[model samples]
Target: MQFIGPDLKGASPMNPTYIEQLFVKYAKINTRSDPARSATPTTPGQTELAQLIATDLKTLGMSDVQLNPANGYVTARLPSNTARKVSAIGFIAHLDTADFNAENIQPIVHPNYDGQDIRLPGATISVAQFPIFKTLKGQRLITSDGTTLLGVDDKAGIAEIMGAMQYLLAHPEIQHGDVAIGFGPDEEIGKGAKQFDAEQFHTAFAYTLDNGRPGDIEFETFNAAQATITIDGTAVHPGNAYHTLVNAIGIAQQLLNHFPENDVPEQSQNHEGFFLINQISGTVAHAEIDVIIRDFDDAKFEQRKQWLIETIATMNQQLDQPRIQYTLHDQYHNIGTAIATIPEIRELPLKVYRDMGLTPNIVPFRGGTDGNFITQKGIPTPNLFNGGGNYHGPYEFITVEEMVTAAEVVARMIIAHGA
Candidate 1:
């Protein structure tokens, strides 16, 4: 079941090519989730996209299609046509784009590149910044024009999932058991599974098609948490400010100085943990700093948070005035611990990829995903690839061949689970 061409009328817009068609539809919609907002979905655009996807699911003739407004999670059921003894499985993808630059993304569809530095109007998608760009020498690559992200991170996942479902529906002869579909909002900000209703989904296992690079099927991610350091400062007249004023910015900087400079993200990779300061702002009267701690090991992750607490306490001792306060809030944790108990669930993606003539790269995610949250919920969920690269940046790309292949993997996984 191959994607012969673009299903233009069936999709939002008529894409000239299959990859172009998918990118056009997703890029046109603005689905950036706001982290600062207290809303469930975090952005209204996500709900709009959820409604649209629910309608698409209905048109595909899937059953129990419902777009719950509580958290804007779209869920659908595909009852088994065969009497195979298999667990019901689910396919999940997020609807919201990352809070990064995503304005008016113009995707460049180049068919069979000659392996040179592909140049956009304003910038170059060079092989230097991304050496893997050389790996895709002759593949048809779809990339942004160096301004906004391609949104291939999860939209590519959505398109691939939809394409595979369409294939399965068309080919009734393909034996399979119950299949579930789920799409969420605010995944980029770590709240995608916060309000996800597992009961409504009713799946024994699931997979999140959200990863960079093809053939990447992950079962582990970093345990994550955020901490805030607030400082109070007294401002006095310059003439009398010498010894009476407590500069909040200076205190905040001193607290950050406690962490090892080499452990930052720029210098860390491949399972190494780090403490990152995501936001910082201060005035003479007050200051606030937001810190994120990430690690795959629970013990180390805890130690990282404790280090922040101890650093703040140590900083407090240096100041004669009580001008600082700190708070550490746990955000999400690694799914490996939970999934370890469900080893059978972890082997599904690997088997699917192997059956598809692709070797599964079983790697640990330095970041996190909705899969982590679902794993903690007692339903083992891993992640699959959506044929994307350079995520959360303007140079993000997904190949047409890769997208079609990913869809085929989804269909194969469903069929295997049913078998």
Candidate 2:
């Protein structure tokens, strides 16, 4: 298959024209993942996008292009042109978008955006709400049509990586080592990198282009786990429901109320951890709730999980029956511990950014990425920015210039490795 789109044969590395075009093209594809689906890639759209990316890589003269439908990972290699045998580096981005309305995404382009409230059909990108918009003045901003997410969470990462690879291929005079690219699916559902073949990827270290905001380099992420609480109750007639009938919904609500309301996602920021009861469903006879526990610190993470266990125990004791049943499973751990051992992984990107006159902002990410699992697999992968804001929602936005800068950073990293 051939890459189908505009001709980017001799495009400059600094030019964001093709990057912007690719962002719009890829964002239009519906690649939203389904957490309920217990399948690799989770949805058909992810496979479709992975195949399309494989075609694009091949068209860009990438070698050894392979698209694995089983894992929905599209991988390709750009063989080093430099004489020195430099260690290979890999760049990865997920294909699937977050669980949001991602169908028929209409990307609205605001050229030379002024700092103000930009109104959409049912939403508004207000400078007051997101003060970051003020810094984006005089830049072209791309957003969704207020009905769907912009899909820029990692698609912008994909475009930036593709743009960097295309730039390297176009300008063969730029010396670089072997560059491997991997685009995986089901990342939004936390299963994208579970089956990632580090042996096949063949890189000393990799970077997940899945973070947001310019100048952001993330190595620390939340240690995460999921808990499901179920309650069983006896149902009886409303008229005869004096002491015989027990409402499971009320018990579920009581369990939720026990959690510290102040320590939730909405009120927490920076390094603070939170317990989020994201989903609830119940009736008079039965009820269930899904909660996720997250923290950056290891001990704190364990305490958060212990709190949930104790809360469940207390609820069960209060009911005088084992009515509340729960299952807690570890999802991913913080990558900071691994990255600390190898300072080069973090220092390399910092050097590249500093050399490019960009201030590198090392942030502790509140959420987990594919890097969390990939790092646990012995490949110390960190995260780089894709240059977007308000991700996973309708107000999401990114600028072509920011994406271009991100691409340049990727290219610089390759060059630094080669030298």
Question: Top model by lDDT, which number?
Answer: 2
Question: Candidate 1, residues 1-419: lDDT per residue as tens digits?
Answer: 22333442232211225434755677657788898998978888888788888888898888899998898899988889887677798899999898677766777888997778888875788788788888887878888888888788788888888877877777777788898989899999888798888887888888899966668877789888988888999888768987888788888878778779898999988889998889999998899998888998899988888877777777778789667898888887888877788666777777877766787788988888888887777677888889868888788888877787788788877876777
Which parts of model 2 have CA positions greater than 4 angstroms off?
1-13, 83-85, 114-124, 128-130, 234-258, 314-319
Candidate 1: segments with Cα more than 4 A from true spot: 1-23, 36-40, 100-108, 117-124, 127-131, 145-147, 241-243
Please provide, for model 2 over 1-419, each residue's C-alpha lDDT reduced to its tens digit, 9 standing for 90 to 100: 11223332333245588899889989999999999998888988888888888888888799999988667899999999989999899999999998899989999999999878899986887888899999998889999989999999889999999998887788787788999999999998888899898889988889999957778999899999999989999999999999899999999989888999799999999999999988999999999999999999999999989988998888888885889999999999999999899777988899988876778898999888999988888888999999988999999999998898899888888888888
Each candidate: RMSD to true structure?
Answer: 4.8, 4.9
Query: lDDT of model 1 at residue 109?
Result: 82
Q: Where's the lowest-lDDT run of ten residues in candidate 1?
A: 7-16
The candidate scoring highest on TM-score is 2
The whole-model C-alpha lDDT of candidate 1 against the native structure comes to 0.80
Clash counts for all predictions? 0, 0
Cα lDDT, all candidates = 0.80, 0.88
